[model samples]
Target: MQIVDHGRVSVGCHVANGWTVVEATGEMDIFTSPMIRAAIIKLLQDGHRHFVLDLCPTAFLDSMGLGMIVAITKRIQAHQGSLRIACADQRLLHIFSLGGLRKSYAFHDSVDEATREVPRHNGLGRWPRPRD
Candidate 1:
């Protein structure tokens, strides 16, 4: 497992059941969102296609953090990958709802629940078009 700590926040990642689980501890704000983004980007570069973002331990989140997740989601989708978010915190859940992102992501109550099923894809791998 690799972890990056920056005083206010700490990020860690590990592979589980064919999925990469990235967990964040502490507040995810302007000061710490980068660590989460960097970790996921590195994992994607490392050939990971499926991911479970375990934000259960996160105590706080800000607009920048939400934006970072949105950007990361787009990047992962563009790469033909999948991302599931595990968050059981009511406050955070309310924030997501208020941000109008509740329907945009697949959210679960726990990491185990999130990793139990494979995300549905369009039957295309990394490349959408076939070679001629």
Candidate 2:
């Protein structure tokens, strides 16, 4: 996936198996909130409720970005889906923890772990059969 720029923020998306991975870079303040929101919403609309937000490359994150994530989580939960966040940045991690988001969202140390752990659902309401 190529990096998509919305002003100073860069967002990239890719799909592996049934997980939709979104890698975000640059500042994530109010100015870049719309881009992030749009990317997430688009994925959900495309029938991709399982998400792995790779934020290791993200340089900054503000309240707007945090709110967007929380909103996405709510939407995913409504659909019986899940959202995992991969963030190795200390600053970002601290912010999430301090904001109480860590308790609400699943945080992973790596993108691989996030993607591997997200549950895959079969439209029939049961989890997809595990792979061998």
Best by TM-score: 1
- What is the C-alpha local distance difference test score of each model? 0.81, 0.75
Backbone clash numbers for all candidates listed: 0, 0
lDDT of 2 by residue, 26-79 (tens): 888888877788878877787877778889888999888888877766677667
Q: 15 in model 2: Cα distance from truth in Å?
A: 1.3
RMSD of each: 5.6, 5.6
Candidate 2 residue pairs in backbone clash: none
- Models 1 onward score TM values of 0.88, 0.83
Instruction: Give the alpha carbon lDDT tens digit for every residue of 1-132 in model 1.
Output: 757887888888888777789999999999888888988888888888788889999999988999999888777877788788899999998888888877667789999999887655621243222222
Candidate 2 Cα misplacement greater than 4 A, ranges = 118-132
Most accurate candidate by lDDT: 1
Relative to the unseen true structure, what is the C-alpha lDDT of residue 79 in candidate 1, on a scale of 0 to 100?
A: 74
Superposition TM-score, candidate 1 onto the true structure: 0.88
